[model samples]
Target: MLATGHADLVSVFLGSGTLTVAGQSDVDRKATRFDPARTTVNVTDAALRPAPGSPAYDFLGVPAGTPIHVIPQTFQPGVLWAGWNTEAIPRGALAGDSVDITLNQARGPGLVEVYLTGLDGPERVWSSRNPGPRTLRTAVPTHAHANWAFTAPGVYELEFVASATAASGAPLVSAPVRYVIVVGPLAAAPTRTTLDVAETVGGLRLTGRVSGGPAHLDGGVPTGWMEFHRHYADRDDVVDHVAVDGGSAVLPVPDEPDALGYTARFVPAFHDLVAPSESPTVANPRAPPGAIVVGVRDRYTAGDTITATALVTPAQPDHTISWWTRKGSTTTPRGTTGVLTITATTDLDGAELGYDLIDTKGNAVASARAVPLRVSPAPPPTSTSPTTGPTVGPSTTTTSGPGAPPTTTTEPCVATEVTRTVRPGEVEVVTDGHFDYGPVIEGGTLTARVKDDRQGTPTWRDPSGYVFHLTDTARTTPPAGSGYDFLGSGPVWTIPLTQRPGIPWIGWNTQHPSVLGAVTGDVTMTLESVNGPGKLAVYGQDPFGGVGDRYFGTVEGFPRSTAIPAGRSGVHVHGVWAFTAPGSYSVTFAFTTTANGRPLTTKSTLAFHIGPGDPAAARPASTVVDQVGRTPSGQECALGTRGLADTGASGDVLFGLIVAATLLIPLGLLLTNVATLAAARRRR
Candidate 1:
């Protein structure tokens, strides 16, 4: 057994069985470990491509809404790869775990480069390059796309690439992809326009024009449907729509309110060639009111009061109406009320009265026609006379008519004559009094009265150089060398004179009491012309009332020569007759001249009174004569006075001689001294 084949056989059989089983199991394990399935490296296609006709992909004239697909044709297992990648990666890795995309224009010529920027923020994703490629990276997957823009409008070939890293730590990239991008040309926008508004008679005219558009285009003015608006304070109203003519339109203003205050606006028609526009607002104007009427009278009398009235319709509360009158150089305010009363004075005889209407602030609205005024003259007073007689007997007269009762009236006193007995060369004192002639009107008669006082001495010098002296006591003879004759005097004392507008004539004193109430003399006056170029005449009317006579005295009549030589002087005897009537008496003196065989005459008068000299006595009760003709009444009188007195040489002659002697003595002494001086010189 020890070296024998039994142990060997048993051991060998067991070992051999065990070895066979172990070998089979070992084979099976090795087969399971070495299986044929395993992971490999692969990638998706990525590049930049153009959408030819899509609207979204339309760059200028390119197709729109097309996808950009970049396929890497040159992509091999170990070469450069380019495309867009939309996968996430770990932080701070090659693509920062975000979409990684790039564009390259290195192989493209004469093409606009592509650029990409952040859509939401200002991040430069990719820059445009003419001969290079630009890249973009993100750390996380995002839906935000970059803003892709082109530098110019043209076709472009861009190289694109996308990159990522594998889970097994191997680098992966897309192939360099060529992208064909088609760009198109650009277009322009429409232009702007304007409108205007103006005023016209019927309505407001709207005008407008279009500018800055295509030169040859007919869209210069808005041509389609348009609207007009009238804007009020409360609301805006659409007036109407109308056709525009050469860039303008018109709309009538509505006749609703009397005063329409509104603004007008024009809405231009909308078209593709012009922009929308409206006009500036324009306003309306104001109008005026109505007219007035005035009323007045036509005729008036001096000192009469008249009224004028103004009538106005639709009266304004603050308006004022005034009446006025304009005479020669004066403007007088009649009244401020509508109705005015004016007192007509003599100055306003032909004045014009007018009226004016004014507003509250003194703006004149209207003026009335001026009316002319007519005024008549004033009237005169009544006249009557008194009776006078002697105390012994009643001076009465009886009148009997056919159908009247017997009537008796007292008459004036008569006079008797008595001569004064006087010794030769005896001077007698005679008392003569004064008379007054009252105020005189330019064209009226004169009246007189007896002045109870002494009269002032009068020195009368006629036009031809004749002088007379009459005093209170006596009348003086004409001076020794004077060209006058001595005229007589009588009991009648003073005579007052005045001038009135009538025929040119004079009245001389005619009648007187010869011997101081003893008797009466004839009422006459003697006129002597000493020297004159004219003929002098004495006119007298007797107290019994008749036509007077013109008397021309001769030189042989001594104190009564009427027709004197051309260069000489004369005098007239005035008082010698008794006055029988108690009324006004007039004596006239006339001077007549002849030139070229034509008679030219001038005259003056002396009017006197015999009784009470009242102004009413001069005014006639019946018909009287005036400048025009004989009128039925007399004018109102304005009376005045002039007086005559007697101035004589009673005591003045001696005093005058003494003055002459004194002056001559001194003159003689001066002459003697002069002669003595001449003699002394001769002797030397």
Candidate 2:
């Protein structure tokens, strides 16, 4: 989403070192960069007027004295002042201290011209009026405006590509960025459409959704027809036109083994001033039928922890994963996750462990895949048989096999292989899922868990086993703004406000069932601490896609608190989650809500593995651990504590406590240890 409005001067600017260009909007005396594609620059009908009678203006080809939509070089109050600038390109950053902005393409209702009207007459920098040069050279550290004259009124896409040679002799070229300009009256509400593909029983199902438009347009449910395009090695072919219903359209296509890719274009039905939008091309890869590949051991020792994982072919995170065990005709539910950890016992020797994969719409994709277990009794301890009555001496039991000395067998402490390591393309991560209180206390108390809504039936995931992977797709330079200055000059990894392939789409929600009911008033979320290689920042954007809220930033300060309204339905929000450097980061967030005149709070550490790294190896700096009895309630979390202390407990015992803590961490009362427990109690 981009910020929309008619500003004095929204310049097409480029970053010198990074070479990423953006629209710099100077609105309300503040400068901010917005995604030009999503931004709507409106040239009101009032901008329409007679062209200058000066002979020099004839170069515009609009015919002098004829009426046209012209945004003058000088500031216009009600009109949009659109122009290009190189002010962002610092000195000595480029080889020639300049860059060339080229007009790759222009499509609209009529001719377009960008020129400077000075003493030299009308100097044409770029014009669709003439079939001549389309490139304009501009020096670094330069700021200039030009007269923008449009022949007709409608939507116009000005494709701009900037290229220059870096100081290091590297060629710097930016991808063609289209600037969407709306000339004259608001004919259409700008819209953004997204396309997604999923494997179906027939072949492939292509789904497209038309979203985003000016809220004032009263553009009710967008009625549209989605044009599906299939790409070949040489050309793209229009496959079909499916009418969009309820803002979305779905087309079931037979698997094309020879097709290169697929894309969809949304053309809004006439009468609706919704702009047309296109989706990125989706690559076609030969994939087999969806099936769950269960990973487990054929045999296990009794009194052991069994860790089993299921990998679904053509991985779909939206699919519901259910682990089950069967002994005879009855099947018991084990868990719901890619990884299932359970204790092994002699009673479960003949039981079969398996899983079922269900689609998002409550449909079974695959089921009944299982493997029987063979659990044997654990080895008994060795004992010494004393001959006759032993004197007043303590004897050690020494058992020898053959001529070798006796060896003692010790059980493993920690179950190190429980959680599965998720990497890019392995699993679908709802990066922005709500770290919220569950609807009801399934265990003993209200705790916070990751509400995984990828599938129809949302599943609660243990934070310890859940990891948000940030792929290289999120690598980008921070735009110019005090809100983003904390990211520094280097390229940072960002989990964007919108979903990007491979990278997790991170955000938070206060949509828990208890939000409006039990959680009265607003929910206070605080960034307790961030432990990682570099600083982390969380921010949101306004309606126009400009920075809105700077909720929490490590570089700015620590323990910053923000309040989110928990209205009738609660709020679902997604923001830009940026990491200064690539590494594992544990961000702790505390959520407090008032229920029935009583205050309840829960804290969870969000584990983010930015860039390349084994997500499994990225452990939360602080973990919730059981603080009490031998048998953990498994629904508790440490309150008022940042980390768990090593209490000289065995690794196995600690691991169990960690698992137990995760099970009920969302709505349970947890304690790091006796000390932290006392501290929490005192605070209460």
Candidate 3:
């Protein structure tokens, strides 16, 4: 008696009503016997597995000829499990026991329900409701399979429970299980990347390329982006992202010192397709040495101080340079790194000074050749002693020779002799004679005289304000009537004298035959009107002007007695004179002024000769005067008729000879007749 497809037997009974053996013994007595048995089947836990090489199992009490099926399933250790199902054998059941087993549980598809936690945002990688559970069963045997359809790449913790009921009406519930799923490649990062450091003006540039990634849609090029990071001593700087064009990227490194560390990474845009990678640590290299320039003076004098300096490009910190001389024999440590100072001595003349750049270990990194020093000798000292002498004074002398009458001669002025030395770039002014020589011109009785019988000191002022004094020996007395009375004047000033352009001297003669009275021309001189506003007056002492009287000439439109106003500074003024007689004339020029309330006065004398006179009286013009030609005394003069007849001894001799000749002619006739009578008598 099987119940319900022979899965379980409710009861089994056997009876023959008091057994046949007992009926033979006691037929009369009524006898009865009964026997009963019960059987049941149950389902046990179901296990999901791989096709082969999976965990194997043995069946106990499974009846022979029972239908058992082996099914294929997909299995992922942390994701899902699917395989064949089995029923539990009854306890104490023999291998041949009468029991039935059936695998009637619905064999649907296998699925994994995944919930992602601990993420920055919400992300759903897989869900069963969208496409329903995947079929875990397959017809093939001993084959590997996978269903990797992850929407995003990240870590996910999965909570899943599998539930099913066996054909025997038994229910089975699997404990809640957890699985950690890393959906994408293990670590999709940059790889085989390189960091090349290049130096720039103010910093460094780092460039690199990454190769590993999904082939780009356009070609086999890598499609992704890269990030660069520079690690400094104190901090890390992250550069901007750059697209991986042609599988390469470049970035500018932050301005920092050399030997700094940095990193580069290649990250794929499709996180699921390619794994990211990072490059090994790379460092920047040191920069090359910069240009060095040394500055030193070329020449100096002995006992002078010398200084030198060196300028280095791209000035580095803690860098030092040493100063040396003569192949490092003479070393002088500089107070500063690049500056040097030394006292120049005679021994150091024509020597070389050198320099070298050194590192912390005192090793020379760069060097410069030595520069030569030229030392000259110091100059000599100058003398400042004052000159002593009476430069100008009047002198009178009387001399008498044998057979000659004594005669007295007077000179208006005579100068003393003195010597001086002048140095370069310097001018010396020397004054002589009495300082109180007053009234340059005076008159007494028939003779006009100079006060104190001495001329004032002669001074010259150059354009550069250098003042010089004329030597007494430079003075000269002029011949009579040249209209120049002063001595120690003329071009002797040494002051730069230039003629005024376009202004000709009116009534003055610059042509040849410059004899004083021969051509009846005017004597002219130019005066530089630089010494500020002043008065210039010309006083003339002539024989025609009687005692205590004199003639005054006009200068620059101003009369001799009146002061001539000085023109603008640097202009030239002309002083002109016209004399009538051929004799020596004394002319005095007095210049007076006040500068800033300081009184000043300058007096000079000019002397000139008029005609060719007695050679004994021929005196050269004043050295200060610019004479155009010979004086009147030096010219040739013709004799007139009256002067020829007055030739004393020669005229008497000619007249006496003529009278003797006239008487001799008559006497010769008378004597000739007598001689003829004598001759006739001598012949008889």
lDDT of each: 0.28, 0.55, 0.29
- Tell me the lDDT of candidate 1: 0.28
When superposed on Cα atoms, how far off is each prediction in RMSD? 68.8, 29.4, 66.9
The ten-residue window of minimal lDDT in model 3 covers: 19-28
Could you give candidate 2's per-residue lDDT for residues 168-233 as a string of tens digits?
999887877767777777666767777888877758989988886543222345666999877543
Clash counts for all predictions: 59, 16, 31
Off by over 4 Å in 1: 1-295, 382-684
Q: How far out, in Å, is residue 580 in model 1?
A: 43
* TM-score for candidate 2, residues paired by index: 0.32
Candidate 1 local lDDT, 1-684, one digit each (tens): 010000000000011111100000001001011110110101112223343342322332333433333212111111112112121122233322332345443222122323221111122334443222244442221111122343233333344454445434555555444433322321112433344555666655544443432222233344443455543322345667656566555556543222223322334332322344443333333212332222233566677777655544345567888778888888888788867777767788888887777887898877655667776655466673211111000011111111232222222111111123222122111112121111111111111111111111111111111011112212122223222221222222222111101111122221111111111222122231223222222222211111123234332233352332111101111211222233444433443433223343433333333333342233222211111111123211111011001111111111100000000111111100000001010100
Better of 1 and 3 by lDDT: 3
TM-score of 1: 0.15
For each candidate in turn, the TM-score is 0.15, 0.32, 0.20
**Model with the higher lDDT, candidate 1 or 2:** 2
lDDT score of residue 212 within candidate 2: 62
Ranking by TM-score: 2, 3, 1
Error of 2 at 675 (Å): 50
